[model samples]
Target: MERLLRIENVTQKFGGLTALNNVNMHVDKGEIVGIIGPNGSGKTTMFNIITGIYRPTEGQVLYQDEPITGMEPYLISRKGLARTFQNIRLFSRMTAFDNVVIGMHARTKTNMCDIVLHLPRKRREEKECEERAMELLKLVDLYDVRYELASSLSYGHQRRLEIARALATGAEILLLDEPAAGMNEQETDELLQIIRRIKELKKTVILIDHDMKFVMNICERLYVLNYGVLIADGTPEEISKNQDVIDAYLGEDDE
Candidate 1:
């Protein structure tokens, strides 16, 4: 399998505190990988490093064999990497359709002159964006509510909308932070199906979530983190039995 993303011995520091220490991980093309760790274990910090929110103090991040460390977030996004925050980020006033269309900004080629003159090129691109936006909305099961304001959607729907917007960015790799954070059982089931559909689209996914069942069921492989360190990585079955991962999550028994 081809490696699509890699974190090579990454270390992140702020002032005197180390958020990530010598962490190494990788994701292959078309694979759904999960990063599971308790809170404050540097999971979000790792995502930030991958997305260029912070440059690693040591080592580097590579995408498709090219170093992407320290690159601007937008630049990295333009290179086909995009992410959703742990908190929902959306245009509260904008319709769902429009919110998704806005996410395609990086893919648009219309210049000021093209828009000012209303050229055929602009019209063609506008049509394409609208069509793609609808396609994505449907993929995430939001087609019926495409005209609703993002703020009016349910929490689970809002999370799915975020996924749609990320897909709108033409991202080959989608990083989702805590996607199942507040979802109920039914909503989480829906999310699982939605993610399977995304996988069918041949997109790679790297997600951080605290729901172990959801993570194990959806992810083909998992990476475990504890106290800024990578403790273990393997298939769900292996990880379930790994002592380090067991200790990290459930603590060692005194008995």
Candidate 2:
């Protein structure tokens, strides 16, 4: 298994509080990893550090064996990493298709002049973007609502739309932040199918969800964080039986 991402002794600080304390993590090609913790346990903070939303105060992050720690968010995105926020952040007035189109804008080769003049190059790029976006939407089972206003969609579809938009960015690794929030059991079940398709698309995912079953079902490995430190890392079965993990977040009766 080739390592797609590696974090070595990462530490991040906000004032006197430590958000990540000498944390180390890694993911391999085509692997689905889960990070679980209580609130303020720094799960999102670790994602921020990996995606360049926050720079690590110590240690290093290597993606594809190259240092990506402290790099700009755009730079990280360009290197085949993208993330969805805890809260949906779509363009409210824009159609779902257009919102996804804008995400592809970062990776499109058409320059300002090409777009302004609507040159042949621009048309070619636009066609490709639309095709890819539609494909991603189909993968997430949201193609029928492509032209619907993002704000008009239900909370579930909106979250699926965000996943489509992130996929549009051509990211090989997706860091999903609480993707199943506010979802019912049925919606979460559908979400699991979408996630399965994402895996078939050959994208590695780091899932952060409140749903314990969702995490354990799809993730090959799990990492438990408590108070900005990693308390456990193991398979779902191992994590379930681990005393430290049970004490930290999953109570003894959780399994």
Candidate 3:
């Protein structure tokens, strides 16, 4: 399998505190990988470094073998990498369709002048953007509520809409942060199906979630972090039995 992303000796620090220390991991093309760790274990820090929200204090991030470390977040996004925050960050005032259309703006080619003049190119691109946004909405199973205000949707639908918006960015790799954070069992099951569909669409995904069942069920491989260090990397079955992982995150269950 081709390596789509590589984090080489990545480290992050804030003042005198080290958030990530010599972390190394890789994600293959078309694979759904999971990053699991307890809170403050540097999972989000790792995502920030990968997505260019924060430059690593040391080390590098590579996408398709090209170094992307220190690149601006928007540039990284335009390079086909996009992410959703742990907390919902939708355009609450906008309609679901409009929120997705905003994401399409990054790939849009129509210039300011074209839009100012209401040129034919602008009209054509606008039409295409709406079409694409609607297509993504359907892909995430939110087409029926496409015209509803994003703030009005249920928490589960809001999460799905956020994924649709991320898809609108034309991302080949999606970094989903706690996508199942507040979802109930039914919503989580629906999310699982959506993730499978995303995989079928040939998109690589890296997710951080506390839902062990959800993560373990969907991710082909898992990387475990503890106290800013990678403690284990393996399949779900292997991780489930790994002593270090069990000690750090999954406490001993009553026998």
Candidate 4:
């Protein structure tokens, strides 16, 4: 398995409080990996560090074996890393299609001068971006609402829209933060299918979700965290049977 991303002894601190403590993990190319723990266990903090929202205080983050630590978020996105937030972050006033179009900006090659002058290259890029955005909306099953304002969609559709936007960024590796947070069982099942399709499309995904069943169903491996420390890293079956993981997150009676 080729390592696509690696967190090498990464640690984050806020004054005296350590949000992450020398955490070590790696995701292989095209793998679906899950990160689960109780709230404040540093799941989102790790995502922030990986996506360049926060630079780790102690270690390095490598993408495709290249050090990407302390890079700007946009730079990371351009390098094919994109993420969704735990809370839905959408352009509520914009059409879902437009929101996705904005995500493609990172990959667009048209210069500002070309865009300002409405040059041929800008026109061509705009056309291509729109087509790509529509395809992404369709992939997330939001094509019917492509022209609708993001805020008008149901919560589940909004969540899918966020995923679609992330896809539009041409990301090879996607970090999803609580993508299933507010979803019901049916919505979550649908989300699982969408994620499966994303994997089929050959993208690597690292998700932090509280839904145990959802994560277990979709992930190839699981990483359990407790109070900023990694407690277990194994297959779902192993994690389910691991006493430490059960005590920290899944209760003893979970099975």
- For all predicted structures, in order, the TM-scores are 0.97, 0.95, 0.95, 0.95
- The collision pairs in model 3 are none
Model 2 RMSD vs true structure = 2.2
- What TM-score does prediction 3 earn? 0.95
lDDT of 1 by residue, 1-255 (tens): 889999999999988988889999999999999999887789999999999999889989999999999999999999999999999999989999999999999878788988889788798998899999999999999999999999999999999999999999999999999999889999999999999999999999999986678999999999998888999999999999998887878862322
Better of 2 and 3 by lDDT: 3
TM-score of 1: 0.97
State the lDDT of candidate 2 residue by residue for 1-255, as single tens digits. Answer: 899999999999999999999999999989999998877888999999999989889999999999999999999999999899999999989999898998897798877877788788788877888888888888888889889999999999999999988988899999999999889888888998998899988889998865567899989999888889999999999988988876776442332
Q: Which 10-residue window in model 1 sums to the lowest lDDT?
A: 246-255
lDDT of 1 at 77: 98
Please give the lDDT score at residue 174 for candidate 3. 93
Could you tell me which 10 consecutive residues in candidate 3 have the lowest summed lDDT? 246-255
- Candidate 4 residues 115-203, lDDT tens each? 78878778788888988988899899999999999999999999999999998999999999999987898899889999999999999
Off by over 4 Å in 3: 116-118, 250-255
Clash counts for the predictions, in order: 0, 0, 0, 0
Q: What is the per-residue lDDT of model 3 for residues 1-255, given as tens digits with 9 covering 90 to 100?
A: 889999999989999989899999999999999999887889999999999989999999999999999999999999999999999999999999999999998899877777898788788888889888988999889999999999999999999999989989999999999999989999999999999999999999999976667889999999988889999999999999999988886562322
Give the better candidate number (1 or 4) by lDDT. Answer: 1
C-alpha local distance difference test of each model: 0.93, 0.89, 0.92, 0.91
Q: Rank the candidates by lDDT, best first.
A: 1, 3, 4, 2
lDDT winner = 1
